[model samples]
Target: MEHDYYKEYYELERNHWWFVAREGILSNYIHRLIEQGKLSSKDLKILNVGCGPGRSSEYLSKFGKVTSIEYDEFCCEFASKKTGLEIINGSITELPFEDNSFDLVCAFDVVEHVEDDQLAVKELKRVTKKGAFVLITVPAFMDLWSHHDVINHHFKRYKIKEVNLLFDTINDGNKVFDTYFNSLLFLPIYFFRKVSNFLKLGQKRKGSGSDFEAFKPGVLNRILYKIMYFESSVINRKIRFPFGVSILYNWKKF
Candidate 1:
């Protein structure tokens, strides 16, 4: 990822509709697990892999102890300062931790950035205790690939089956919940990306910016956040959408 993009991301993550809504969705899932007696908030040990600017790590801290790791040194420093947590400089494919270490592990929008995504997933599972939860989120569909993916240095988007297959590699892992989210705006986002590609916008500029750069906080932002937040409520009921802009998977190592 470009340096400037990281700076932009740090600034926008707090209030951006995408970040805010995504966090809400993830939080809903965690809260649901606690409600089901599958997880306990007290004394939970969480490993937040690829914790970019540490917002998610900070949020995860509310549940229990959070160990954050980031590949970029700059992001490690930035996140450490922002969250006041000791951020480890590390790679997901080669996590610096003992086997079966964490009660809960998360790698949101991280695996796609790795060239060897399988190794990343394996490492994630390796450090997670038996019967512990692993939560992952990734961009959905190769067809949805756009400047947003490119600027973010993504390897590829995923189909539901593909994501399932990735987790299936771990014989001991059972998928407890999975869904495609950001569904409400998929059509509009797809159309916008198509039009932007046709216009050759940002095509010539590699390492320029991301889709988030175009977003400005306003009524529309608030509306989108509310829409996704409602979608999250449906997801908490284990209701699944047929398709969406991103995929979320919740797995338990057994």
Candidate 2:
């Protein structure tokens, strides 16, 4: 992401509906797997790759022990202090863990920022045990590419087919167990991105505050959160959404 976006992330993730809903959805997915006997909390050893500031550790802690790995030292420091969890400052391209070390590995919105996404996925697979689950989320569609991607220094956004292919190759031929287009708020966000790109808004890329210039009101925020909550419920039921501003998936290691 952009240099100072961590501060923005810290704030937004704490209060933003987008972050809240996404985390809820991911939590639902994890617990669902647990319910199906696919994952056992007693034997769980989780690796949160690229876990920024460890904002997710609270929910993740419900499953089992959590180990956070971040490429940035600043983020590691912040996350460690905030979450009080084990935080490793390291790169995802080369995870400093043994083969099949983790029962679950989750990478949230991290791959798009990686230069070698394929290598990163391979590293993720290398660290996860056979039949373990890997949950991930990434920005979707090149058309949604705008100052957000630019400010965040994203290497690229992904389509459903593209991300699926990337994971399939690294997952030992195992297909993604469940994949869905997320962000039920996609239409509004799409239009916002289109307008921003068309008008060259924030194209020059300033500092950290550019992202919050358009923050919504409290009531609207709650309303959007509710909508996403319902959509996430739909996803929890295994109904794959056709499109969204982002993609979320769970893959089982073969």
Candidate 3:
């Protein structure tokens, strides 16, 4: 990620439809776990892997103490100043922590950035305490790949089955929740990306842009947020979606 991109992210992450809605969805899941007595909201040792820009660490702070790590030194500095929390500089494939360190581990949209995603998953599981939880989100479907992925330096997008296999290979955890989110906008986003790719839109600029750059705050943003928030409400009711723009999964370490 470039410095310019990080600057844009710091500005938009607070209210962008994609960031805000995804946070809402994940918060719902965490709240559900608390409600079910599966998790406690106080005194938890939480590890936020790949804590880009630090908003996630700030948000996760509500549940308990949050220790954040980011691969980029710039992101570490940017996030620490923004949130006033000390952000550790580190990599997902080689987390600098002892085994069974945290009660909750979050790696939202982080694994896709790693070339050795399996090693990344292993590291996530390694630092998690036995009986603790790990939550992850990743872009779904290679078919939906676009300039957004390229600009973000993603190694690959994921399918539900691929995610399942990624976790199953470790064999140290049980999957508690798994669902495809952003389902409502999947078709619209799919078509837009497809059409955009067909016309070679933004291909000339390549690394110079991303989907985040397309966001404009207004009625459309609010509407998209509301749509995804409603979808999250449905998901909290234990309804599973077959497919969508992204995948969110929860795993409990054994």
Candidate 4:
């Protein structure tokens, strides 16, 4: 049976303010990739690993041919309907594709849920072309664990050094372009949330209705989006963060 909570959250994400804000952040990141000449509409074949409901693929398709791979059959179906792109259903440990077939492979906010993140990274490396970009975003800091992490089945959040270690065994030719944290606003909030959870202070996964209006106040949402856009641009130029809610990384095969 499908996890009802996951499904409901995804449906909410389809039109949620938090979701739109995240998309804007991604757009800024993609723009930077374009500015660096890493993404091109004419030649790049983009793959979005663990693509949820295909929103990222739809955004990325403007730059290249996009194919999204999702493990959930429902997500894949929804993604196909939403983006009109091909959706492959499979595990990250075993990507259903030929080696060196894509120019860009992206997995956003996905690695933490995998039991074997190292194998998952290796699988991603195997499917990309030489010097192809591998972009990933994952929750940062295991210390920030909360009820959300428990409900989401997250094995562990990442530390920069820990993630770097996972890439150590990857082909020597593969180079890390950048690694940095994202969601600056949520840093302190997450710290407190984690602390609260750690203390067992009324810890519970907020149901779908909770936070439904967190972003509904459009003024706040728009302002936050603009701030994040600026922050994202700055970070893309150079990855540096004392801490954050999530991490974004860029790597390329040699």
Q: Estimate each model's TM-score.
A: 0.96, 0.92, 0.96, 0.85
Expressed as tens digits, the lDDT of each residue in 1-254 for candidate 2 is: 54367766777776877778788888888898889888996959999888886778667889998888889888777767766777889999999999999999989999998989999888888898988878888988898888777776789988889887788773274755555554577888889878887887775546553444466549978887778767767876888888887888777787
What is the C-alpha lDDT profile of model 3 across 108-191, one tens digit per residue? 999999999999999999999999999999999999999888888999999888988888985699899899999999999999
Worst 10 residues of 4 by lDDT: 205-214
- How far residue 127's Cα lies from its native spot in candidate 2, in Å, is 0.6
Could you tell me how far off, in angstroms, the CA of residue 7 lies in candidate 4 after the best superposition?
5.0
Worst 10 residues of 1 by lDDT: 200-209
Query: What overall lDDT goes with each candidate model?
Result: 0.88, 0.79, 0.89, 0.72
Cα displacement (Å) at residue 222, model 1: 0.7
RMSD of 2: 2.1
Off by more than 4 A, model 3: 204-208
lDDT of 2: 0.79
Q: What's the C-alpha lDDT at position 225 in model 1?
A: 84
Worst 10 residues of 2 by lDDT: 204-213
lDDT of 4 at 237: 67
Q: 152 in model 4: Cα distance from truth in Å?
A: 1.7
TM-score ranking, high to low: 3, 1, 2, 4
lDDT of 1 by residue, 223-252 (tens): 988987789889999999899999999999
Measured with C-alpha atoms, the lDDT of residue 97 in candidate 3 is 93
> lDDT by residue for model 4 over 30-66, one digit each (tens)?
7777887766647679888988767777787777888
Alpha-carbon RMSD, candidate 3: 1.5
